[model samples]
Target: MEHVAKTRDRITLTGVRVRAHHGVFDFEREAGQEFVIDVSVAVDLAAAASGDDLARTVHYGELAEAISAAVERDPVDLIETVAERVASVALAFPAVEEVEVTVHKPQAPITVPFTDVAVTIVRGRA
Candidate 1:
């Protein structure tokens, strides 16, 4: 008798941060600052594991590119919006069942220097 290992059914990514400019302040939008983003997606990887098909798995490269594009394409007033957009993009993949996005602004022009400022959002397919 032969035993076969069951393939994992979920996919997760973490610490996917990028630098960009996103803020409501005029200086932030004009001067261009650095913003970091972390994202994770719950996806079904069984198909890809069984069939060895790239299409069956969510491509991290593409996901990263999409996030980068979104961050660079426009300037928003809030990190909440950035988180929402990143989560939305992650959910666009058919294999992704749910997504979590966190946007960090480390260099926010606050009155005092802080460790970091960030926003996290989660979204799922209905």
Candidate 2:
């Protein structure tokens, strides 16, 4: 008989863009800015695979809401802070083993015109 190998599944939510006030400049808070978020979570899918239940899987909508809430609730000076907050929230889920969050700012007020600026962070169970 041949043995089957078990593998973990990863869930990802990408391009979750939200306009918020997150920047080092005062105008960022007063006028607000546009930001984008991307999140990836690694989870154990054995139970969800066998059970076929939504509860067994990570709810991306909830994750997006959480991220949005965090960003909107607090004003930060850097995208690094935003990334950290997003990763921390994603890792709060029991099923999530690892999380990666990226925050993108396309309209950053820079002296030189560029495509975009972003910050990425990865967090896992310790």
Q: For each candidate, what is the lDDT?
A: 0.78, 0.85
Which pairs clash in the backbone of model 1? 20-35
**lDDT at position 93, candidate 1:** 82
- Highest TM-score: give the candidate number: 2
> What is the model-wide C-alpha lDDT for candidate 2?
0.85
lDDT of 2 at 102: 88
Listed per candidate, the RMSD to the true structure in angstroms reads 5.3, 3.6
* lDDT score for residue 116 of model 1: 91
After TM-score superposition, the amount by which residue 95's alpha carbon in candidate 1 deviates from its true location, in angstroms, is: 1.0
Worst 10 residues of 1 by lDDT: 4-13
- Largest lDDT belongs to which candidate? 2
Instruction: Summarize candidate 2's per-residue lDDT along 1-126 as a digit string, tens digits.
Output: 999443358888888988888888998889997788889898878788799977887887898898888777688898998888888889888788889898999999988979998888889878
In model 1, the runs with Cα more than 4 Å from the true position are 1-19
Candidate 1: C-alpha lDDT: 0.78
